[model samples]
Target: MSTPPRPGMESLSLILLRRPPNPPDLSDDEADKIQQAHLDFLDDLRAAGVLGAAGPFRDHDDPTLRGLCVYRTTLDEARHHATTDPAVQAGILIADPITWWFREGEIHLA
Candidate 1:
């Protein structure tokens, strides 16, 4: 049997990164700028100890699986962070938040 979660354990949020249905027509430079901004945002989160892991999929053409961010934060805060991404604000991408649960110390990244 699985053990129940202990009280006061923090919950995590998973941000499902996806491309918008009708992405804005942006020049290469504009797209690069937005991408950099998004990276900076994630870096900040990592520095703040909120971001656990984040990365994009290999297939850029895939509509369903674009990228993801697993963070230690409330759902509202995760949504706020997701909306802060320049790509999301520009309608180039969308972030859907989902509450996640995992055993502590089990999820690690290199």
Candidate 2:
């Protein structure tokens, strides 16, 4: 018997956050503290599967992180989760999330 086709995955929204510019007068310690808090928040999101990947943008020297997250259900849920993230709560990151649709090709996520 032939295998049945897999069900389609719904398009999900992705949240992208960028770190604020560092003040010329801000101390390194202060920056470290902020980063730590953001890390803690990301840990929570990872546990919840709301965050796919969270890391610093390595295209150049800066505190910006190129992040992406897939919402489990609806756009609202994704927004709620992103807003509640530690980085967002601590003001370490600001999110501009966008909805995206994708189809599985040779690789499968299921």
Candidate 3:
């Protein structure tokens, strides 16, 4: 009937990347450049110890769901990083981050 509280939970940000309406049509070169910049941003986050995991989805049911970013930070921080992403800035992708709570040190990415 009632749920019990769980201890040792960590607050994380789960960013859901979606397709932007009226996204810009870019040439292959420009698209590649934006992608590279996007990767660079992720790398920067990783170096700063803010990013937990991030990657694009493949063969998924939802077409709008492009990728995701799990951050070891609050929603505000994750939003800042997502909005500043080159891909998001270029309208290649959109980022919507939500708070996620899980057992600390339970999930790991390789």
Among these predictions, the greatest TM-score belongs to: 3
Cα lDDT of model 3 by residue, 1-110, tens digit: 11224777666678999998788999999999999999999999998889989999999798888998998777787898888999999999988878766677877755
Candidate 2 structure quality by residue, lDDT tens digits, 1-110? 11224456346566777765652344688768767877887777677676655565566555476555555446677778778776576666777777665554532332
Q: Cα deviation in Å at residue 103, candidate 1?
A: 4.1
lDDT, candidate 1, 1-110, per-residue tens: 12337743435688998887788899999999999998998999899898889999885667666899987777888888898887789888889998866666666644
lDDT of 3: 0.85
User: TM-score ranking from best to worst?
Assistant: 3, 1, 2
- Between prediction 1 and prediction 2, which has the larger lDDT? 1
* TM-score, one value per model: 0.79, 0.62, 0.85
Candidate 2: residue 13 Cα off by (Å): 2.2
Winner on TM-score between 1 and 2 is: 1
* C-alpha lDDT of candidate 2 relative to the true structure: 0.63
lDDT of 1 at 43: 94
TM-score of 1: 0.79
Best by lDDT: 3
